[model samples]
Target: MSGHRTRKWVRVAGTAQICALLIGMAAGGCARLPYTTQVIHEDRRVVVTLQRETRPVPYSHPVQLRTDELAAALAGFSFREKQRLPLRWFAEEVPPKQIFRSDELQAVVPYLVEGLQKAAPDERVYFQVLAPGMNPAYEKDTTAGWIALREPYLHLTLEHFHAQFPVRKSEQWDLRYPALPPEPKTYLLYFEPGRFWETDPVTGQSAVQLREFLKIAIPASSR
Candidate 1:
């Protein structure tokens, strides 16, 4: 969760440590990281472009991203209100609201994964997730962001997320701006490499990973 998207990225510091989450599962699961030797790959298009590079971003062998899984995960991930309610409370829990939808995820995740592989040591993979405005006359609501692999930790930063003002101009128009889309709280969750890496029982070596975690819950999938 971050403040209204700005030019600044919200950095999650002190996160280079190995993540032990799901270590047992990985040890038995055998899911490997999508890494590549070509070290440089690019996908450029009218709306976006992504490059995945390695060097400054030190990575080992075998780069392959399960773009489908990644997209599904991104499509499912959401932001929810943080307030705690008592068990006796009569009100229902708030639903989780997704930041991106299925259609957008299908179009965006592949490029993002590819770009991460082609990133320059100092750069990040970037893109904007968009939603049409409620009013036809306005610009689309957008969530602008980037993803970077800072060694042990991968960072996803949403720098600018803002909804456009719907304009209705007239002498007798309502005297105020329309309400914009709801924004998310700044939340940065860290899962160590262990969360992504799994040990191969047969090879006695750990297979690296580019991973995603998901929990099943219905979400309001929109901005």
Candidate 2:
């Protein structure tokens, strides 16, 4: 069968078959994807956040760190890892065309679906993407009299994710970062929990309530 045909078949197979496949793999002691979970208690409800680093730099031996002096010299070049909460149902963004057949999705989707269904029973889940050069305002200013056009491939990509996951809603956004050179090359995945508006009695100001937030950074080549 063609590769596309195979993926179509897999999607049609649904979650039950996927769950059974996972169970079989678990029985063989196969390694699953890496994830961390965190639990938060606020508003008298337990909220969990599951996170996984999508573009982890693999460990490599230092070429010049054999001596203590050399190690000290290179210390300034190191970066601190971002801290994330560990919880069940970690979701990561897959590149545009790869979501349907990605090995990572195959490994994690079943668990993600099950966790959300059980933990946040009534909450609407989201799968969102943000791509570069998609700024509506920027495009409007530059194109003059033309409607801002989104990349056709990106539209198909969003549709693919909608069909693949049990997503209550899906969306795409444009990002504007002034400090860094526009990557024009990265895609971001966001998992947003349901939101609510609250008014402060003291200040009389309305603000949005943040339940949970997680993001996955996917590189351009991955798409």
Candidate 3:
């Protein structure tokens, strides 16, 4: 089953590659396909592989970086450039249904925060972004429609927690967690955004998209 699942992705990836080529030709600009290169949680880093023009490009370019650095890099890229990275985090208008419905993944927000605190102790963690909304503010709470959370070490199902939590039309928040030493560790969580719907161009995608989620920033201190 694992091998079949892997192969299925490979085939889907091939199809996406062809689609990229078609779209790139139409746009007359570099077309890129998203792909995963490597994910090292112990190092708190994930690298994505990309390809363009039948040439190998950094799809989801791999980098040795903390969560914040990852988030910043992802947000800074253009939409076209973003296609190169196979990150699920994107600012789409449609809600991520596929992830939420999966039994393999679950959301437990407060629990995640508590666990991180227990493990890291003195570290101050802050959330840069989470569901219902997305913004740059690191301290102000949401009005009523959105929710966001930032912190030191990003726990698994961080998105699931926010999504399942109550919120109005849209929400956004910035949460900070304590800091930890550079010593290596591995954090793992299964993220399932169930039945992905079309992205609303205006909103892009869910407040927490695949690319954005993987870019979990572990800050040194809270602002």
Per-candidate local distance difference test: 0.45, 0.26, 0.28
Error of 1 at 40 (Å): 13
lDDT tens string, model 2, 72-167? 111111111122445212322211222322332333333333333333211211222221223432321110000000111001101222112111
Model 1, residue 65: distance off in Å is 2.0
Enumerate residue pairs that collide in model 2.
Answer: 36-86, 36-87, 37-86, 37-87, 38-86, 38-87
Model 1, span 172-218: residue lDDT tens: 22222233444544532222323554443433333323333322222
Q: Sort every candidate by TM-score, greatest first.
A: 1, 2, 3
> Which has the greatest lDDT?
1
TM-score-superior candidate, 2 or 3: 2
Give per-residue lDDT, candidate 3, residue 195: 21
How far is 175's C-alpha from truth in model 2 (Å)?
A: 43
| Evaluation by lDDT, superior candidate among 2 and 3 | 3
* Model 1 score (lDDT): 0.45
| Per-residue lDDT over 1-223 for candidate 3, one digit per residue giving the tens place of the 0 to 100 score | 6988976776676667668767989989655632222221111111111111234311111122333333332232211111222343452332433222221112222322332233222222222122333332322222111112222122221212222222232221111112111222221222333222123243233323434434343334631
Off-target runs (Cα >4 Å) in candidate 2 are: 1-23, 36-50, 54-160, 167-223
Best candidate (score: TM-score): 1
Question: What TM-score would each prediction reach against the true structure?
Answer: 0.42, 0.17, 0.16
Candidate 2: Cα lDDT at 79: 16
Residue 139 lDDT in candidate 2 = 21
